[model samples]
Target: MAEKGGIHVDSARELFPRVAEVPFDAEYKFMATFHNMTDEQGKPVVRCCVKGAPDVLIARAGYYWLPGRDPAAVTDENRKLALAENDRMAAAGERVMVVARRDFDPTTFDPKGNLLDLVQDLTLLAMVGIVDPPRAEAKDAIARCHSAGIQVRMITGDHAVTAAAIGHELGIEGQALTGAQFAAIPDEQLKPQLDQIGVVARVTPEDKIRLVTMLQQKDNIVAMTGDGVNDAPALKKADIGVAMGITGTEVSKGAAVMILTDDNFATIVKAVEYGRNIYNNLFNFVRFQMGQLVAYITCYLLAAFFFVLGGVPFAALVILFLNFLISVPVAMALGFDKPTSGLMDKKPRPLKQPLLSTSQWVRIAFLGILMAIATVYLEAIYEEAGVTTAATMGFVAFALLSISRGLSARSETETAFDRDIIHDRNQMFLYSMALLITILATELGFLQRLLGLTSLSGDQWRICIAAAIALLLVDEVIKVFLRSRLHDVKAPVT
Candidate 1:
């Protein structure tokens, strides 16, 4: 990291009597200063000035300081030995690199004349290998991903043998392919086999982009993780681009939609769980609101038709008051619903699937029409008694049906009284409060007048209450039928 005593050399033209400092890639920096003494001992040495493959000192400049004259540092013999050593260590899953620095003459080498410019004559110092074992929890995380029907792949610019060795150690099983092999494969030929190729090694940035594009064409939702300028294109191309905040280049981070502060792979699993829940919650809100809207329109039209009224029973302000005090609050509370069991056990939802299907819309229509019929039937009975109570009772039924909708919204399979609903205290409270407020508003004299409604007699109130209860009863019966239908639909055949 530092050179205090040695005269700096610029290339082989001017050599330092002894070179002191080198880059992080110079793994022998610690077993160093013996640098010169060790060089005399013939330690697999090669000369490096400022250029070559920037291995461990990736993306950095001026970090390397070498001082030698010979440009033939990488002779055929040296390359052979280096490759042999790299293979040996890599077979043991070690990341291996050869360190090289330059020898310099002490008097002529400039200590301060632009370190990068002057330190040109490079020398091969030593070959150092490091083993960065995966984290203890990484295997477990991968296992969880597999269980949840997710696939994990490793793509790197590392050597094929080294990458494969590491993949095996990490319990990753897949056919190995180099970037060149991938590039050579025709797109049509590659589609079916793409899922089998796990470890892609010696890949350039273009290879990564091609992989992402190919995966997308196969209708796979690809989430690409990267942390370099070269990674920007593929990251942008992915369905979800994740960047490592700590180590990612600005270009890559800008292209990515999600940035991982800790850069932990397991964090992605957690994110997926939350993302699915957020979407489910949004759907629940939509399902509830849309159903309520449909039911209100149905019930309002039926009552108006039965009573021969030209206009709606409720005023515009009444609708707003009811929505504010009832619907919105309850919907907001539904957002807090706990994630269902085995949230991560399911495969990823289809990207093409809509939030609601046609069948769900039909169910909504049925629920709405039922509420309308119940309300209209009650309105007719009250009007027949000459009590002038049908209109007020119709409004009550509307509020009541809206309140009961939460139960249906919570589950498609589970009934209102099922364990999933009964055990959820938040949901129970939300349901209770919505029902209580709606009932209270209809009964309260001041609120009823404010809503432009006449007060109902006690007996008439009982009738409205009975009719409202029927809507829930009808809903429960429908739920039971629906549950049975679902069971039959899902039943495995012999």
Candidate 2:
């Protein structure tokens, strides 16, 4: 056994025989060991080892045994054998160590030597490059964003040429800038360049942050997408940060508001549609509620004024009941309605736009006032015929208004007659509920008495149904005119 440091070797063949030649052994035992080394500051550093079978031992020490003469011309055959044996040992989960002496001439290996010269000896391992192909749906999604008044930009660490190529493929417009170009611009100057610089390449993490800040300075709501650790900071700074979960680092995902599990650009497009739909529904419901509130307040105030003047009209109280109980339920049914055709095709409403825009307020005001006027006029005629028709006329008017309001609330882009809106199962369900409520209110004695209302006579019922049909027809007519105007405006001009 020969001992060196922590290694102990036992072999039948003598490694350093004093004679002219030494006999080779069929079997050998070899080992190499090491312990941690400490620096001058007493910090422990990693240790290493080198030892194995004679041929194995020589190779492990990074030495090539020559057939004759020089000790360096071992050829490729021996090198192949050494690598194969190492792989076999590795497959068995055995750790194998390779040791090699530094072969550089000390005089030539200067500290300031060009690193590229040393790197030239490194052959191509498998090409370690990424091919981030645009998703098939990315182009369509980009077009959709453009139509929706949203700008899409590509910010990447890839080379300018590669980034521009991808941006072109994804349909992004404007100039492409490398990191150097972006860095050369002052922060104040970057603000005006955001719209014109659509593809930013080789940008650092700080560059992304600055870009987002510059966009924010212009009051643009930026939605950024990224999948790297460096992207985390920018993701957190954007209005909406979308992370590609499939390819994103944990840091990026943690900072994002939304994660795309499939990393498909189409997902963002779908999400935008859904978000807009939710906001639209919310706005519609609120507007409808506001109209109902205004009507209720007006009725109560009028009823109080009339009572104070000693008139005390029962019809006013009836109107109040109708506004709260019947009109409100019908308007709520509009919330459950299906999305209008071309909903996604329309641009997103400006975030700064008031909740009650002029057009929306005008529609609500006109419809509510028209409904009230028509109800009162029709009831007045029924009463003028003089068959003790106070309760009956009120009931008929209330019923007509309730049903017509639903049709009036149809999308500006579509009519109540539109197949998609009319055929939605949810809308159908709401209509069924409305019908049930109306029927039950008419039949139930307590409800009828509380509201000073009554079921209609056969002839009176026919008139009420006719009035409802007329109201619906008027609602449809308004929608058709508005929809036609909208279509004309949206149509491509020759």
Candidate 3:
């Protein structure tokens, strides 16, 4: 301690070594390491001696001191001044703390290991100031979170001024209150006004649970990030708890739903981005599959009654091939499509909304009606032909309709030739593959005999092409209408 350039000015202790006593267990509360130092200025021999030092060391360890004196005396003036100075330092973006050492008149009062003897008379020691700067990436990360509509609040145990100063430096502005202020609110008033809180200081573990609960009461999808044993309860109560893997305690990690390995805020933004893309891909698959499902069921059921009321148009084996080989592959391709351009630009979807929305079902119904009408018209044209040829024509027509919807399912904002449409090349390839398999099943003799398919003539192929192109027009028109001002302005991800 002497080599560190710290001057040990033990004016009263060094001159009276016998006046010190051992630092008991309870004295550590005021950050008091030892209270056994002798005050030889007042006493002769030290009954029990310990070390006496200024409050400078204690303050550096993050503690503030409280000095007491008579009601109308000037002795405690310096301690009050020290506390005020520390508060000013705290408001200037520095952590300020204080320390003290006290001694009792062992003669006038019987001294023991009790509070009356320990806190009899106090001596102000020192105040400390510490500055811990923020990281360069922190401000940028916070800004990104704001853009993404994620609220970032700082919960700390520092003094309110200290927390506010640091928050200001980190781009977190607004009113900040201490935990005492928050807890003072009546239970009835607490919930109604909880959302306005921005920064909380001098917060306890119990305060954390209260904050999490209040935010949840406002219907927030809370994502609490914590890395301490005290943070376990809040982490568990959050909707999506994020724990710091590197700095997080075992208890906190166990309570969290996600753990950040690097403990970086920017990573969370990246996660939201990818999460939105994944959701879009999933719904894209659903929309594509559902749209075609409606069309196929409508067309096939109508054919069941009109063409093959007593018998099946396509065998069970052929239906299996159609579903597995054609529909499944297209659904998979849409499920893995790239992120759309305006995915992040839109607000988050409501948690309670159904997977396939009402609007989506309406679109599916429109496509279904069109496909059924087109199939019935084509089947009527091929009525004079044999049952096998008429059935094959209807199958080819429905296959064309499914392919049209699959490709059109790429985006609501882009057309077939839009430059961004190139991202769906894999999807287009699957469509081509599905078409090739359908043609082969119809043309091959052994497969045709096995699957009950008849090849379409040249004129029949032209009619199927016309029906497909017409249905594509219908799909595009409805998409353009939905993307207009009549409904949601955010373009749907197909």
Please give the CA lDDT of all the candidate structures: 0.68, 0.61, 0.68
Give the per-residue lDDT digits (tens) of candidate 2, residues 256-278.
Answer: 99999999889998998887777
TM-score, structure 2 vs. true = 0.67
For residue 111, give model 2's deviation from the true position in Å. 16
Ranked by lDDT, the better of candidates 1 and 2 is 1
Task: Look at candidate 2 and tell me the lDDT of residue 441.
Answer: 64
Write one digit per residue (lDDT tens) for candidate 1, span 271-369: 887887777777778887887787778767875675533336456776787778888767876677878666676677677988789988887788778
The true-versus-predicted C-alpha distance at residue 248 of model 1, in Å, is 1.7
Model 3 per-residue lDDT tens digits across residues 1-494: 32355656475446444333434221232333333334545553223222221232223222233355322222346545655776788889887654444444555433435442444234334455778887788888777666666677888767788889998887776669887798787767877766566688877777888888888777778888888887889899989889999999999999999999998877777788889788888877777777767766776676676754233545587668777877777777777777777665566666677887777788778877787778766766676687778667767887777777776776654555466545568766787888888788889999899877788888888989898898888777776776675356545857
Off by over 4 Å in 3: 1-140, 165-174, 308-313, 410-417, 424-429, 443-446, 454-463, 486-494
In angstroms, what RMSD does candidate 1 have relative to the true structure?
Answer: 7.5
